[model samples]
Target: MDRLTPLSKPDPVVTLDEVKANLRITHSEEDVLLARLIASATASLDGRDGALGRALMPQRWRLERDQFCYGIEMPLPPLLSVQAVRYLDAAGIEWDLDLTDVVIVGTDPAVLRARTIWPTVLAEPGAVAIEFTAGYLQVPEPIRTAIIRSVGSLYVNREAAAGAAALDFSGLDPYRQWAFG
Candidate 1:
């Protein structure tokens, strides 16, 4: 089974002040509420589980696999760096692959390539793991705008609505990932 886990949480891409300004909320009375909304908005569209299927802020991730194929595709785009690769031997001993033994290639769909033959891995589930950092050092302006708009929609419409309070995601179309079989 393939699994992806976040090693660290990404800080909110949209600040409380920014959300407040977008909502024209000047009072500190709702600062706490606004902060929560900002976090929710950002989480809804950030990282692997996000709608964008991408990381918005710089964050670390671990990808676990049963075996190393010819090359491993770093699913998250805008990959910043590959930190480490590790595998378990047949005897269940963990070994760290030397960073010099692998290289990162490409941009749109970053890939991890082994410079040498891959070390033997245990023939079992999750025997190999790769740790890397991915995401934007600076999130795109449109992404930030989308989050703000989502928060605004949620704030203004506390009650469920059929359409009047729907969150607008038109700004996110260009950034959203569409997978095809």
Candidate 2:
């Protein structure tokens, strides 16, 4: 996991040419949601503490659905479980690409030097393509081939969801549910 001057999100504005928009996520609202929920979540767990928080949430942002690019910072664990991915995916409004979009930004020099941290452990996204500032990276072929030989990546929500506590994921069916059909 690359590190930088610790900072909270609201990362500086990146021109459209700077982003790759891997999943065709064209709405600024989507970007905002991703930044806070996904990126912020990942960053929270990533190494570097206090400082990295500030930079990651820079207090502001600018978006352009008319543009897209890749490369960014995020925190991801190695022994990443399939269920974790599934839960995260389920949380998403809709996963456009076969992969998940991870945002990485930190304020630790050591992290940047390691470079191979989160991105290095990047797991296969099936057909999904993870995109960011560094570049829109597809789950390296080797990983996909390997995971294919593994068990499965499916999510199930047995309990009923309540108000406020309820998620607006009514549009998407469970990956397993659709598969069984």
Candidate 3:
């Protein structure tokens, strides 16, 4: 799975104003630096877990498979909706699968289950495409806090220090997806 739409604005996990407040800055001198740090921190946290937390903003993701498996697990969490599912037939004709044939289950890395059976696809890489949107309309409190702290930490420590204390990410660890089996 790959994110087709890289983080563009309309919504950011943490805004510039929010970051500035976290850093306790009242001036705009380092606005550019703060913005970059916020983006970097958000990207770092977003990719930390395989499938945990919401996107915090609407974004597109594409899941590709070599064939129509019995069950396909989505790669992102808190899925808001499944946009489309397109497949390449044996004859090399691309077709969109009917919504009735697919069922979405669970919010964390939403699972896509085939109703009866999965259709055949052209035997090749990425023969099936699943496009979906995952995220929250507003960033959750814990996630928002994590982003704020991370930006502050990154700003304070521009470079790694050999003996410096590690940035506490324990607050964010609970939000990660852990495998039990």
Candidate 3 at residue 136, lDDT? Answer: 69
lDDT of 3 at 42: 71
Clash list (residue pairs), candidate 1: none
The runs of at least 3 residues in candidate 3 whose Cα sits more than 4 Å from the true structure, single-residue gaps closed, are 1-10, 47-54, 159-167, 179-181
Q: Give lDDT: candidate 1, residue 42.
A: 79
Summed backbone clashes in each candidate are 0, 49, 1
Instruction: Identify the runs in model 2 with alpha carbons over 4 angstroms from their true place.
Output: 1-20, 49-181
Worst ten-residue run, lDDT, model 3? 1-10
Q: Per-residue alpha-carbon lDDT of model 1 for 1-181, expressed as tens digits?
A: 6789999988889888888888898889988877877777777778777778788888999999999887788866778998889999989999999999998898447878889878889998889999988888889999998888888887887567643345566768788766411
Instruction: Summarize candidate 2's per-residue lDDT along 69-140 as a digit string, tens digits.
Output: 243222221111111111113333323422333323342210111223222222323322222222112323
The candidates, ranked best first by lDDT, are 1, 3, 2
User: Lowest-lDDT window of 10 residues in candidate 1?
Assistant: 158-167
Per-candidate TM-scores read 0.91, 0.19, 0.83
User: Which has the higher TM-score value, candidate number 1 or candidate number 3?
Assistant: 1
